[model samples]
Target: MAIIKVLKRENPYVQIDKTGIDDPNLSWEATGLLTYLVGRPNNWKINIAHLSSVKKNKETSTRKALLELRKYNYCHLFEIRKGGKYIEKFYLVFEVPTQYDEISSNMDVELKEGEKIFYVKVKKERNSNNLPEVENQLMVENIENKGVLPNVEKPKMVKPKVENQALINKELLNNNRMNKEKNHEYDFEEKDDDLRKIEKLFKEFGIDFSIKHKIKIKELLQKNSVDFLISHFKKQYEILKKKENVKSIAAVMSKHLFQGTCEVDSSFLLKKEQENQLQLQKEEKEMKQLNNALQVFLTLPMEKQEAIESEILKKRKEINPQIKKISTFLFHKMIVSDIEILLAKEKLI
Candidate 1:
């Protein structure tokens, strides 16, 4: 992290209105120092000597100003060491006044840069001869004074609309009765003979007669047996009409037989199974090739083996080097002596 210093355009004393004090001897240096300290970025610590020169006569005044500024909530005072020396460091700590009473009269006044159209009230008093003492005393008095009472407003009440429970219940009952009558009418209506035949076909195939199953069966029927089944049912209906006890033409037609067809070609399924078996065989062959490569790698010189081991160790930083060596041996299915034999043959050592 880097320390960032922001320079304010106006003198700290002028910004805080300390220059306008009646006493010519009044030191506004403390006010300026406080302003600067408070304005620093949070989490930064500074030494007291960094503020001004250390002198016996000025030391008491400087210390007093720092303390006074803290009392007014302008800065946070603490001790710190800078450049191997112990010193006091002040941190600027400004908090928005929770109450109007918390505002200080002697402090510099300015609208916050981003604030708009805000007003506040302050008590006015005659300027006294001991301006610094008067200012200090006023600050003390303000801190001691109890805060003002907060203003509170009562919320307004609203009337709710009244509903007739009896009327609502009667309307709900009428809706239910009308729905029941509609359902009864639908149940008594005659079903199409061709649709009945499709249903019978699903039953013959031992398929679940659910809504989804029926939809699937209908789609299959449309693609396959729709025209044949309709013609067969019409013929059955004509034969039944010749008999005297025919209760319904639709019912008689509904007795006709149905048969379904498959979408997938049988030859296509056999071809797909054959391709899957070839893929499995190819995978097995690749495994055998990897095993052969490992065997060849193991039959190398000791020096060559060490070089490869070092490379593997370096690459496997997060893993234990010993565990990695054991894993490599097991993976390749070769011993250390095998490595030396291969290395000698290749003249690598």
Candidate 2:
């Protein structure tokens, strides 16, 4: 039997189950990632990009680790959808394999006004370093009730009598709170800017939306990102403008604002535009070459031009013994163009 040694400390700590650390199904990278994520506050947002930013972390490894965790039921991925459309996604970390039937069953229900259900599952039931005392206790109780890692006994925590240590923890907690507030404020300013840009776009498009319409758009912004919404609305506006019977631009925009059919992937549009540009460039170059070839034919002596045309005409006669009746102008035009083609192919231009 392996003997486990327990240690106690008054400083901040994150509780992770030995069973999780010793899980044979998980690789070292995945286990380490789970430990780091479990140590963050419940409300902390996590993604592969953020995880890869940690020292000595690689994006490919982090992504694979997340997939591995998901496969083993240690991490749960949920899509935050509104009006039957996907808006965002988040993950929930658990120290032990968690039953996800309850969470999955609630995912399909449409959200009502002023209702918040996802946060309860994500943030309200967990605690980690820097959590408020009330929440921390609630999480402790919840974890105990769930019977996760039942083999590891809870260690008794004894606070040190040092005054400076208490003061330092207090100061660190306050600083964390301040930083969260600042980030919240910054997000508010950024959202305000997005709203202003959308308003300007509406004006440019001659869309006369009422205050009610503006409120509806603002609510949509909360669910979808500014860039996505802008792209969707712009494409919808263009489509509506081309319709012969479109009566109201504002009405059309409002109608399709939340509809999944109106959603256009901006990257797809950019790729299509690039392909069209390349085709146009190719055509222009070909036309330039054709014109240059024509100019070279004009500079050739009359006798030489006649000889080239005769050679082409002979080949045509052999292909079709009798030439089809064509207008004199068209026949001459064909002969000259063929001469140009022949000259260009022969490097005579």
Candidate 3:
């Protein structure tokens, strides 16, 4: 395949570190999500719901990508509390992972009057046996003597001896492995329960699910709720019952449950058209009956119409005492219904 590339030099571009984009630990989804988040303005509020609302970004996928970012330290979630009550939570995005504390500590040295604090930054080697780097420090001296204090000799560092360090490490590793296995077993049981529940649902609908159906249901569950899946299944079954040559409901469901496209036969379309026509005819008959009732009510004496309206209002208030007012449209609609019942009893319509 031939490839063509074009570059655009524009102000509407985000500058991201190549390290994060090319990180092996992150998937493409996570990398793209990170870049999108980093490009937003500093004051822009961050939220999962808003992020998921973007085109082609679903809540499930966005949440999974966020988990990946959090795992690699590309993002951090913090909760802000006040008066020991939870206020809100926020996320912090980083170009790369670095070791630092959220809250900074003050220097232990005392400051003299009229003296300024001189802070220093130190870069330490990664593997060197030295103290960690300090972000801020004050260089203070005893001012009473009018001279800088002499440097004290640094204490020699020592490593404690552990006779069974190797055995301890092995035991810890074994314990970690056992705990992981237990967690895995629990997860497997939960998945089995979900699968069985889905199977039970299929059986309740008089449908048998195959291995393929089971796998598809698992995938559907990842992006949809069980209720949604069941609703779709019922709709599909209802449609399939009307279509001829549909041998297996489960087979058809595996293809079209949550996001599948369905094609109905001409006969099914004809049947649906007939059903719609019947519905329209039924509505027209009801409308004619209602209009006849309204004409009869209008011809009645003023006192008779008022009696019907009062009866309706009394019954409605008896049922719901909180109803203070009714709209004109609804009141007339209810008046028409009461007139119809009254005329029907008198064998008028």
Best by TM-score: 2
Model 3 root mean square deviation, Cα atoms = 27.7
Task: Give the poorly placed runs of model 1, Cα more than 4 Å off.
Answer: 1-264, 309-326, 329-349
Backbone clashes for every candidate come to 6, 0, 0
RMSD of each: 30.1, 28.3, 27.7
How should the candidates be ordered by TM-score, best one leading?
2, 3, 1
Most lDDT-accurate candidate: 2
lDDT of 1 at 301: 68
What 10-residue stretch in candidate 2 is worst by lDDT?
A: 1-10
lDDT for each residue of candidate 3 in 1-349, tens digit (9 for 90 to 100)? 1010011112477656677898999999899987777666543565677788884867666776776776676765544455555545555456665222421122122234443323212222242345443433222112112323346899999988889999989999999999999977864675677777778888877766777777677776667777776666677678787777888866776566545665455676789999999999999999899989988877889898777767765654322111113123323543577678877887877
| lDDT for each candidate structure | 0.44, 0.62, 0.61
With candidate 3 superimposed using the best TM-score fit, by how many Å does residue 227's alpha carbon deviate from the native?
A: 55
RMSD of 2: 28.3
Residue-wise C-alpha lDDT for candidate 1, range 119-208, written one tens digit per residue: 222223334333344333333234224322224698998966659978978999999999999865543342235456766754554433
For model 3, the stretches where C-alpha displacement exceeds 4 angstroms are 1-10, 100-349
